[model samples]
Target: MSRVQCPRCLRPKTHCLCPLIPRLDSRTRILLLQHPSEVNHALNTARLAALGLNNAELIVGEVFDDLPKLLNCPGYQARLLFPAEDAQPLQAYSSAPDEQPLLLVVPDGTWRKARKLLHLNPLLAALPRVTLAAGAVSRYRLRKAPGPGALSTVEAIVQALQTLEAPTSFEPLLKPFEALIDGQIEAMGEEVFQRNHGEGKA
Candidate 1:
């Protein structure tokens, strides 16, 4: 028999992470575009991010037909959170209280899938790009990072929010993400986790 799942958080009833998800408000709006394939993945961090932030939205699809409405949020300058040669560093907005808060458009998928998202949505690609500063680390231990600054969807959102809104910590948003990781580790058993992905392993 299948286990029941929480209406929110979507974790199995026995391991529900709803209690840890926060409903924090942010000046900057977040729009997470997730590939359909990622919806049912065991670690659907994008859903966690959407639930935790009052100003965020999560949409699942390969091609977004409503890019016009999605990117046209008033009082917020829309910026794609993807690295590019000319992308502006996110830290630039940290201290700019006079400037408009961003409508951060993030693609939640693997490297290739995220690229596909940008490819499919020209308007999404046309938005000015913003990137996190270098040397940031990922807290997700279960999977190999695709690159140096790779982070899970929730982690990336937290980092971006914290950077764009300095002094207003968004660390609380990560509570459920951390819990989910711990649960995965516990389920894997210490011996297997240590042998495969423990300290200095992956």
Candidate 2:
């Protein structure tokens, strides 16, 4: 028989990070666009980000036909969280209190797949892009990144929300994420895992 999974975090009962999930009420909302294939990936951080933030929406698809409706959602400024060379630093728009509250659209997938998301959705491509703070690094030890300066979806969302909304509201969202990574490393139960993910580790 299969082990029971937590309906919320979708992890096995012993591995569920739901208890540590924060109920963050961020003024800036999150709209995550996930590749259909990544919905069941064990290390998915997009779901965690949505689960933690009260104002988050998770949409799964490679090509979206209803994106127009999403883009036109009232009272929210739609922006893509992509790291294109010309992307504006997120803080530039965030520090302004007069700007519309953000609806941050993030893609969840490998680098190639993420790029495909941009390519497949012109609406997503045309949206203004926002990049994270300089020197920001991902603490997601569970998965190998596709390239340098890559951050998991949750990490990026957490960092972005910190700038876009009240700092205190988004900081706690990472606690469950850290716990998830630590729990997975502990389960690995090998010297290689222990030595690599030590103190001061990324």
lDDT by residue for model 2 over 80-125, one digit each (tens)? Answer: 9988888988763455667788788999998789999999998899
User: What is the per-residue lDDT of model 1 for residues 31-127, given as tens digits with 9 covering 90 to 100?
Assistant: 9999998999999999999999999999999999998999989898999999899999887364555688889999999889999999999999899
Whole-model lDDT values for every prediction: 0.90, 0.83
Off by over 4 Å in 2: 92-98, 143-148, 195-202
Q: After superposition, how far is residue 121 of candidate 1 from its true place, in Å?
A: 0.9
Off by over 4 Å in 1: 92-98
Candidates in order, TM-scores: namely 0.96, 0.89
What local lDDT does model 2 show for residue 153? 82
Total backbone clashes of candidate 2, pairs 3 or more residues apart or in separate chains: 0
Q: Report the alpha-carbon TM-score of model 1 versus the true structure.
A: 0.96
Candidate 2 is scored at a TM of 0.89
